[model samples]
Every structure is written in structure tokens, then in C-alpha cells.
Target: MNKLAYALLTCIVILSLSTSCEKDSIRVPVQTIELSASSFTLATDSVRIVVAQLSPNNTTDTNITWTSSNQQVAIVDQSGNVKGISPGTTLISATSPDGKISASCEVDVIKWTLHKGGLGFVEEGINAMALDKEGNIWICGQNVIKLGSQGAWLMNNSNLNPSAITFDNQGFAWIGSGSGLYRYDGSKWEVFTTENSGLKDNSIITLATDNTGRVIASHFNRESLLGTGASEFDGNSWKYYSSANGLVYDNVISMAIDKSGVRWFVTTNGISSFDGEKWKSYGASNVGVAHIGLVHSVAVDSNNNKWFGTNSGLIKFDGTKWESFTNQNSGMIGGSVTAIAFDNNKNLWVATGAGLAHFDGVKWKVFDRYNHPVQDIRTILTTPDGKIYIGTGLGLLIASLRD
Candidate 1:
């Protein structure tokens, strides 16, 4: 009885222990999968794309499938290649069949283009511009132009031969051409030439009006005709002045009236100022103005400081001293400054033959066609809203200072 009982008991215990061990060994493998790039941005032409895959402990799992929720936007292949169809957002997902693990990434497709209201207009060019006291912009450049809150052409004469233009306090626009001066009182164009009105010369090169409603113009002399230094329109009659009347140069290119109602005439040789009483001259000999000595434009800042744009560089007269800035010294990109204007913020905007440059008392910002090239920025004006309008040989460009 003892031998048979002992053998049976030992067999039963061994069998029970073996069954428990077998049950515990039957376990399922855990699956883990992860994506490499959280987000993917691609152009609209990308075809073959590779996304990394991460597994906990299994590397031999080659059975991976990729899919996109929106096939119209993006499509994914079995080899993890993603193709972009259009500009939109789509979710790309990858799954490992063997491990039963899945991962997903967002695909974003975007397109880029040049903004017209920004610095991109530099590729074009500008010609001329005028700013009213309210900071409204009126420009005449390449194509049809306007400015500020109200985009008015300011010159709808349909005649594109205007040489120079000036605006008075009453918002009247005076345009100078080969014929004479044309006045625009926001409605129609009135022609004032040597044949009809009191214009000193028919070939008017520049125009300027004083506070006393006196219109001043400069004329260029050709062979058959005599060039007048300056002319005055006192509402009733026309008065012409030349070298015999103590004028510096007969060939006038530009003109500007200072805060004191004094007329400043710019010529190919030098600069001349005329007060109500006498005429004064300043040029190469007295004022150290260098380079070609040809004054192209002149402007008066808010502080009553006179600024001159010459073929060489820029000069500032503070009544007592003279400060000069050229391409070599200041950040002016070019020496040929064609136009100059002061904004409401007292920032000086200079239009050069090359591009546009701005000076805010301390720093200088130059905008060229390379970075944001504006071709031949003939005129620069700032609106009251701090937006800068550039008149280029191509068309009109508007830039936001807040940017």
C-alpha cells in the first residue's frame, strides 16, 4: 500500500506543476510604433517622401502601409512616399500590420507669391508723386496712379508730357510741361502758356507757388528762344527774370519756396534764392556743394531745414551750418537723388535714380530691386496713416511702415 500511494502522489504533483508553467508561458507580444516628423510641409510637386518609423523592439516589421484622409490634397504610398496634389491640409497615417501599431502626421501645402501692397513693387519703377497737407497721395508715374484714402488721379488731362508738378495749400495742382503751366482745381485742367497767359516762357521746367498765391516757374532756353531764369504769376500778369535781373543761372531745373516765402531756384550750374527785396546765390565757390553741381530737387523739412538733392548727393542747410550726405558717407545707395520729401513724422524720403532710401534722423533704410527693388523711384510720398507711396517708372507702389 505504501509504494503504490507514493508513486501516484509524486506523478500528480509533477503533472500539476508542468500545467501551471505552460499556462504562464502563453503571453502576447506588445506592439509600439511612432512617427519621426510631427509635421511636414512640402511644395505642390513633391512625389516620393520618406517618413521615419520607430518600434519598441521589433525591427523586422516591413509590412507597413501609408494612407491619407484626403486623397485630393495628398496621397501616400505603401513605401511611405507622399505626393502633394493641391494646396490644403491632410492627415497622413502609417500602420504596421505585423505589430498592429499605427502613427500619423499632418501634411501642409502652401504657395508663395509677391504681394502688390508690399515691398514687391520694387521690381517695377516709379516716376512722380505729390502729397497734400492732409497726407493724401497723388502720383503720376508709369500707369494710372492715385493715393491715400481717396485714390484720385490728380491729373486726368490724358496728356503724359508733364515735366514737373506742384500742389498748393488749397489742393490745387500745377503741372509744368514744354508748353506752359496747367492748373487743376480738382475738377478740370486750365492751360496757362506763353501764348495765352502771363507765363514768362513756354518751356516751363519747374513750378512753385508761394503763400501769397504767387505762382513761380523756371524755363529752359533752346536755340531759337531766350531762356528765362524765373517767372512770377501774381494772379493778374506774368513777370519774367533773366541774367540781367541779378538771377544766378538762366537754365532753371527745379524750384522750392521756403517757410519765409523765399524762392529757391535750382539750375545746372548752382542754386539761387530770391527774397522779396534781394537775390542771393550759393554754389560751388561759397557752399561746399560737390559733384556734378546740378540740383535736381529741393525740399523743406518741418524744422524749416532746407534739403537739396543734386546729381552728386544730398545737402542739408540748417540756416547756420551745412551737412552733406553722399553714397560713400551716408547709407544713400546712389549719388543721383532725383526727389526728396518729408513725411508727417519728419522722416526724410529720398527717391534716387537707383531705388528708394529713407532717413529717420538716426538710421537709414535703403530699398532696392535686389532685396525689394523699386526701379527709378522718381517720387516718394507718405500718407497720414504712415503708409509710404512710391512713384516708379513702372507704376505706383504702396508700403506699410508697420511692417
Candidate 2:
């Protein structure tokens, strides 16, 4: 009886020991954990899925909780779903129930690209232009158009007849309302008319500002009591220009101020330049203008080279010689130059009645109906981001500068 009982007890103890060993092996901790992606790159405001793999090929508590070092840069959820919040780098980690086992992934978030869109509510042509300090360009025609993030916004469709609109250094918006000049002082409108304020005439053709913060406005066809051409407002006082100020023409159409603070006026007769106190004249008989009449607009380049848009052709005056570029000589596909602007790269862009043309100082690029998008390129404005805004009789065309 002792020998059989002893053998049976020994067998039972051995079976219990073997069972204990199997349970101990099943309770072993995970050696290491890894993520499906060691490093992840995603665009801002986008999301991606990730997974954590545990070692030993076992499903013993395979579920993992995810976290991010920087929630503003990137965010992760319990299911290992990662989302990019902004442009930055963050470390995303997956942790088990115990702090001893964890896996990490580097997440990089990139910036969102700017989308270029169109602004197309104007059934009529866009004629006037005004640029603000915030890099916003406003257009005026039958409607008032403003640039928005999505596209062009037609702020006001009624015809205020904004022949000109400008922002003074003091941030006052001056809008020409045909019979009177309206100034928007943040919220209220202050009207300045010939009968009320010191304005020379009721019709304000164009307004210009100098580097010295002097605002000068020209009358389309008004005679001043002082016998001058344009009215100058020094924020407090007003003055006029005419024969008394050495100005030969009183019918001023356009004006431009150079970087050197010299203001130039273009009239039907010719051009006149003023530097605060001194004045100079350049008529059709002048050497710089070269008897060329019908100048529509004038612009000064970064190098102080004067460019004139004329009905016949484009003229450039480098203080000494006169250079002419017409449809006959250059690659300009349009006639009747209307507007002129320069891009960030210093490329001169011109809008004409027929098409648009660009000159890179050596080569000329002409855009017409054959290969270009705009036909009647009336007013051309180049944005700081290299987008070209062409306001035509039909609608607006935005061209990317990257192309």
C-alpha cells in the first residue's frame, strides 16, 4: 500500500508543477513593441492611420493607447489615428497598460498650400484701382471688387463712379464720388466738395500720394481759382497748381510720385514734374517726351526709369534718352496701352485694349486670345504673391506667378 500511494502522489505533484510552469510562461511580459510607421509625414489639417505591433505574435492585450508630445503640432487618438494640426514636428507614442512597454513615432506636419481662385461677379468692366497696406487690392467699375481668401468679393456693385481711390499714410480711404470726394475715416464718411472743402473741382480724375505723405489730386477738366492744375492736400491745408506754379497744362489726367519724392503730372499737353517747391516741364516738344502725345498712364520703375503708357506706344525715359516699344517693334500683341505694373521680378507688365504684354528687359512675352486667357486687358495689378489680376470689360483673370 505504501509503494502505490507514494507513486500516485509523486505523479500528481509532477502534473501540478508542469501546470504551474505553463501558467508562468503564459504570463510573461512583452519584450518590445513597434509602430507600423517609425516616422510619418502629413500635410496640415490632414489625418492618417497608424498601428502598434506587439512582440511574441500574441494578442494578449494587443490594444494600445496613443498620445502626442505636442497636441498643437499633431494629435493621436486611442486607436492610433494621427492628425496633423499645424506645421511642426511632434513625437507620437503608443503605450501599453504598463509604463514599461511603449512605442514611439516621429510625426511631421507640413504647411497647407494656398489655393488660387477666381473673383467673377462683375458683368461690366473694372476701371479703378486701390491697394491697401494689408496687401489687398480693390477694383472699381460698375461694381466695387475686393480680393478675398476664396476669390474676388464684389463689395459694392453700385456705380459710385470711383474714378480714383487711395489710402493715405494715415489709413484714410479717399474715394472719388464724381461730384464730391468722400473720405472714409474708419467708420464715418466725410465729404469734401468744391462748395464745402478746399477742393479745386468736383471731378477728381486721379489721386496720388508722395513719400512725404502729401496727397495730390487732379481734376479731369476743371479750372482752379489759383490757375493751377492739381490740388494738393497736406492733411491740413490745400493748394492748387497751374501756370503760377510753372505748370503749362491744367487738365491733369494722371500723376505719379518717384521714390525720390518727386511728383510728376501727365496732362493732355505733356508732362510736368514738381519736387515740393521746384517745378519742371516736359511738353510734346520736350526731348524726353519727344513730341509724343496721348499718354494715358505713367509709372516709375525701381531704378527710377519713367514709363509712360500712350495711345500710340509705350515710352521709357531714363532721364536722358527716350525708348519706344510699340506693336511694331516689340512682342506686344495689343494696342492702346491702358495700364502698367511691375512684378516682383521687375518684369514690366502692360495692359492694352487688345491684349496683355510683359517685358523682362530683354525679351517680350505677349498674351493674346490665341494662347492667353484675357482679351481686353484694361487694368492689370500684380500681387505680392506673384498673382496677376487682370480686370477686363468681361471679368477678372488671375494668373499665377509660379508659372
Candidate 3:
């Protein structure tokens, strides 16, 4: 009785102890598995990749499975090294015994390059440039030159000592030279001078067209006559304006038509705006034009901002306020801004007497004569492909902003 009872009691106690130990083990906490990356970039020639994992709750499990959607594009290793083999998109995933998490990135193996074209001159000085919607370059300067693809010269009129040239919506080229206005109809030139047309004077400084194809020319008397500032060609007749006719100055330098069809004139005195009925003048005394006299050129940006290149510096008008920039405040490179053009990227390219200045809305980068032959940049033009052509006294210089 003693031997059998002792053996049975020991067995029962050992069974009870084993059951308690199993229950205590089941109460132990479970940890979570997390995945992370050092970097998401992958090289084209990489063979393997490395990824890190942190098991704050499950410190015993370090083994994880790496997966990828496209093995040809990229493949991951146990260490999380993603090797890029080709150009494609793939999803990388990591899994552990506890849970699974994933992160993905693309791999492009082909090289990216930006090709820029060479520079071409107009053969003669460039006075102005007007681009058509068809990518045809109509250059109005001393010589009437038209350029297109493959360096093709569509029209090269050496007889035109053009002072200002503009293109209408009808593709007709209106040229202003020492003579009067001339229209090129893609075949021949039609001369319109004071001989028959109603031009106030023979010398035309600038030419602009309204939305209705009405042409306007800024005329200055070579003899320095006062009260003879501007003239307009209404398809048939010419109308002249001056101080006697409510003009601020008799010597007009530039002309521009705003988005609202309002004509703006820059004269030797200040800036004048004409709404086809009334004329309003603004100068240093009233607005912040930098100078009351000698406003050389005027251009309107896509945002309806007015840019004035005056004898003093550059002035910008935001319809409500005027902001002036010079060599001191802005990296203008020169005090006298001669021409201004806005590129497709909304960057303002300013040509001054010293060099070329580029304003990316916030920052300014000045390219002087030392870095580029930008001195005496009389005109700034942008091609359809975003290439910049600068017309200077030296000749025509081209550069690419993408580079």
C-alpha cells in the first residue's frame, strides 16, 4: 500500500506542475515586426539591395522574406539590397513571421540627356523678333530675315533697313524702317510711306497691333519736332497724336498692346496709355517708373504685369504697385535695360547695356560679357523649344536654360 500510493501521488503532482507551466508560457506577450529603408534610390547596375527591419516586440525572430513584383527590373535580397537590372516599375515587399509590410520604388536604366542646338545670327542687326504659332521666326531689324527649320531662309530682304517689325494674326509682316510702313504678304512687299499713306513722319521707332489687327506706330521727327509723338494705321488711314492731342511726349521709343487691348507708349517723357478714346500719362512724379524720361522699351507678361526698361533701370507694374530693379538691388548687370522677354518657363530674360540678366521670379542670375557675349543685348527672344537667342552688338548668341 505504501509503494503504490507514493508512486501515484508523485505522478499526479508532476502532471499538475506541467499544466501550470504550459498556462504561464501561453500568457507571454507577442511582439510586432516592422520594416524600414535607408534609401529608396536604386542604381541601374545594382546586383542586390539592403533593407532593415526592427522587431521591438519579437526580438527572437530576425528572418524575413523579401519579394518583388518584377524580377527583371529589380530584385531584393535578404539584406534588402534592391538591384536594378532594367527599366521598369516594381513593388518591393518584406514579410516576417509576425506581420508583413511593403514599400515600392521605380527603376529607370536609360540615361537622360538634353540636346541643345547651335547659334545662328541674323546676318544683320536684330531690331525685333516676332514668332508665329507655326514656329516660324520673323526677325525685324536692319535686314528683314525670316528663318525656319533646317536654317532655311524663307525671306531675306536686304533692302529693308527695318527699325521695328511685327507680325499680325493674318501672318502679314508689318515692317517699320527709315521709310514708312511696309507689309510683306509672304510673296512681295507693299510699301506704305508718307508718300501716299497717312504717316505723321517718315521715321517710325516702334510698331504694334491690337486684337482687331489695327496697327499703331510710334513716330519721332528726326528733326526733333515737338507735339508729334504717335500715329495709328486703321487698315486704311493713319491717325497722329501729340502733346496737342494729349500725348505726354513727342519722342516715342516703344509701343505695346496689353491684354485688354489698351495701347501703351513709352516716350522720352514717361509712359502713356491709350484706351482708343482717352490718353493717361504716368511718370516718376506719379508712379514709380524709375525715370520720368527716356523709357526705352515696354513688354507685358502673361500675368498682365508691365515691364518697363528705362534709361535708369527696370520697372515692373503689377496693376496695383510698381517694383523697380537696378544694378544695386537686382542682379541686373547693367543700369539701362534695353529689352525684356519672358520665356516659356515664366522666367524673365532682361537685356541691358552691360549683359544679360535672368530673373526666375525670386532669384536673379546675371550673365556678363565675360561669361557670354551679352553686352549691348538689344533684343531677347525665345524659340519654340525654349532656347534663348540674344541679339547684341557683337551678333546673335544662343544658349539653353535646361543645361
TM-score of each: 0.64, 0.64, 0.67
Lowest-lDDT window of 10 residues in candidate 1? 112-121
Q: Which stretches in model 2 have alpha-carbon errors above 4 Å?
A: 1-123, 150-159, 221-228, 288-291
Model 3 ranges off by over 4 Å: 1-124, 154-158, 223-227, 288-292
lDDT of 3 at 308: 92
Model 2: per-residue Cα lDDT over 281-317, one tens digit each: 8756666544357667888899999888888778888
Instruction: Go through the candidates in order and give each one's C-alpha lDDT.
Output: 0.70, 0.73, 0.71
Decreasing lDDT order of the candidates:
2, 3, 1
TM-score of 1: 0.64
Top candidate by TM-score: 3
Q: Candidate 3 on 280-307: residue-level lDDT in tens?
A: 9998888845465678889999998989
TM-score of 2: 0.64
